[model samples]
Target: MTTAVAAPFRFFSLQVVRTRRLGPSLARVTFAGPDLHAFHSDGRDQSLSLFLPHPGQPEPAVPVELGWESPRSGEAGSGGGWWQAWRELPDDVRAVMRSYTLRALRTGEDGHTTEIDIDFVLHGVEPGSPVQAGPAARWAAGAAPGDRVVMLGPAVADNRAIRFRPPADTDLVVIWGDETAVPAACAAVESLPAGTRARVWLEVPHAEDVQDLHTAAEAEVTWLVKGAAAGPEATLATLRAAELPPTTHPYVWIAGESGRVKRLRRHFVGERGIDRRRVTFVGYWRQGLTEEQLREQG
Candidate 1:
């Protein structure tokens, strides 16, 4: 009998089809598979779950004891299938699961996905370097054409992970982020309506990391390159000194280092007097802390 999977962690098999370097620090990997036709996306800031393999392991193995019930057993329809199931896994096993935004998603006239692009940061590896780094980054660095991985993403186009929500009457949109947030930011730009206007401040490790963004919205983007100024000190200085255009009906989106996100939140709500209701803030990552560590601390 075919099982109707109620679990959000339902797996969809995919394989790498190609890879491209978008900038000095970003590597774009394209994946394709038959199951992709059911891989729905909400189009803006849409992120998905990826399961990568440990070094020396060809594929991921989610043990039954870890609470990841297999669809084959028709047991995936049970209790909290994300974190609760995750908590049951060994720490190293849990570390292999990471979240990533869809840089691009394409569907064919036949209503099947011809391709999907995911841009990965080339982190923790250097010329003649050892492979001690995040599992996801290591996997992407070694991922070749035909390499496979599994995803737990949207089964329907409308899902909660697409967080770029602004009221219809919003006349101006403000966005900010660092390299890690670039995929989501660019996706937001792509989602704006034809006449939408936006001011975007994006920060990256280097100027070469900046790439062209495609959008119909009238946008002015300022690229912030990280230098000697530590923390959000440089970005905070720039944002404080800048003369912002008159905002009619404004909506703000901010995501980056947790510390920076906090500062940005204060700047908008405390200093700029923007209503707390008009903003979406996400802390993608933090310095010296892994995602799991943050969750545990929180």
Candidate 2:
């Protein structure tokens, strides 16, 4: 659903203002453009489809018409509208469409949007190479101040891309994820109302990868890193050893590897008796598979 591009969404041409390594495996790229003034989001894990250029291209490839809607033709953005039209273009022109969470956003007092930050995981396919160094990682690793790309993001304050929707009766909140889910968890945590009770567990690749976190909610954060005797098994060990609060009205959000997320979901729903509907679980990516492969499977 993050890749859904349609009305209430439009193309925004953005230029990179700067890029910095946030941690050993994370890079934060700040983007700015005139079109960003209309970009809006509700902040909780909001997603956008990025159009990154091929290795040597100056600008990202896009259709000349900039996708549009024709309700008279009965085409929705998914079935026969944007998705279909995008598919009809040449493979090289369509480029690579990847979904990403909005890490941060700033607006000026004059009411104009100033900047938006997106964090990219410096992962590659091989160990010591990053998590999985594909085109996005390649771009981020070498991004200059003026690099540009296109994205189909929110134009309204509240849209469907935000996947973190907790119920009104929710009391305790539990969120966990690997490095890829950090941006999502980061955005979602700050949205919690003040005094809300929440527990956050984040797993990254390095101890230096543990960055600062802020939240108005009563949050307890724990960082698990690779090679720190806190790998997957260690995560399960911690989960099994801990005592969680009562779960009659609990809300849980889990993301990362498909298998791990499923395991956590079962633990909460099967063991903890949390309502299945109260859990928002997403597998951002799967091990041994790329985003393109996942899309094809979907």
Candidate 3:
């Protein structure tokens, strides 16, 4: 007899209740919603689509409601509530969509108010980048108790076609990531079995970029400072040179800029001879595209 596999849950939206600076260039936004109750916390590395309103708009219309059972096709929902507000947004304002990770999730006693955290990487003083350091940054930078923004995401986790279930006796793991993927990489490291030998390579712009991370496994971390040549391609070369135990079963995860991730994926699976299943490669962001744009390109 054959058992049927359950269908994966679809994505949904949340309301940003607050936002704050986690570090110099990292902004943490906290979101809440009923849908979060169904979110799979074990899939921490997954990407989420975030919908932000036009700068001056007071209230934004809501898009379609998403859930485990929601049908895949439909016009944006028609209610005059949050959903309507989003539907009526001006074309220019409607165009602003960003992608971020589900950094962490907290389920309360009643499972009603799930707090989801997302970190936005501030890219200098530019205006167009998500979480820029300009005027809009002030909004996110100083967001307080009552401020709110529309959020839609926690898209299904990227389960690579090649799977590697680390053996019970496996000794080591290696994780490499850029700022865009720090949350996911950190979460993966934290979830590993206790006493598992692990090494984490993180590439960030500044010294303050190194936050106090929480992880359960024994981890030796290396931080790559993007000083002179801060491009993603340059950083990957630096990280690849760092050595790991060749004999140990190393489950490697590398994620970040698209170009760099693509190159590393080729090098590891093609040249280095590591089984494709042993490595998870994700392109968290591309050089010149927004999160939504990145999705469209993919």
**Whole-model lDDT values for every prediction:** 0.77, 0.82, 0.63
| Model 3 TM-score relative to the real fold | 0.76
| Reference-based TM-score, model 2 | 0.89
**Per-residue CA lDDT of candidate 2, range 1-298, in tens?**
3796545767889999999898878999999999898888888888878888887788887652635443345432345556666778787777677888999899989776789999998877336663457888888888899998988888876887788998998888999989989998988998898988898889898888898888899988888776645555677667777677665688899988887888888887888778899999998888788887888787
Error of 1 at 159 (Å): 1.0
Per-residue CA lDDT of model 1 for 43-95, tens digit only, reads 78887777776766666654434443443453442345444565676765653
Q: Between candidates 2 and 3, name the one with more favorable TM-score.
A: 2
Question: Would you estimate the TM-scores of all the predictions?
Answer: 0.86, 0.89, 0.76
Give the Å shift of residue 227 in candidate 2. 2.5
Top-lDDT candidate index:
2
Residue pairs with colliding backbones in model 2 are 123-130, 123-131, 123-132, 123-133, 124-130, 124-131, 124-132, 124-133
Model 2 spans > 4 angstroms off: 1-6, 64-77, 88-93, 125-132, 228-232
lDDT comparing candidate 1 with the true structure = 0.77
lDDT of 3 by residue, 112-205 (tens): 3378887877666334544445333445565555455655443333432112245565677777788888877776676677788887888877
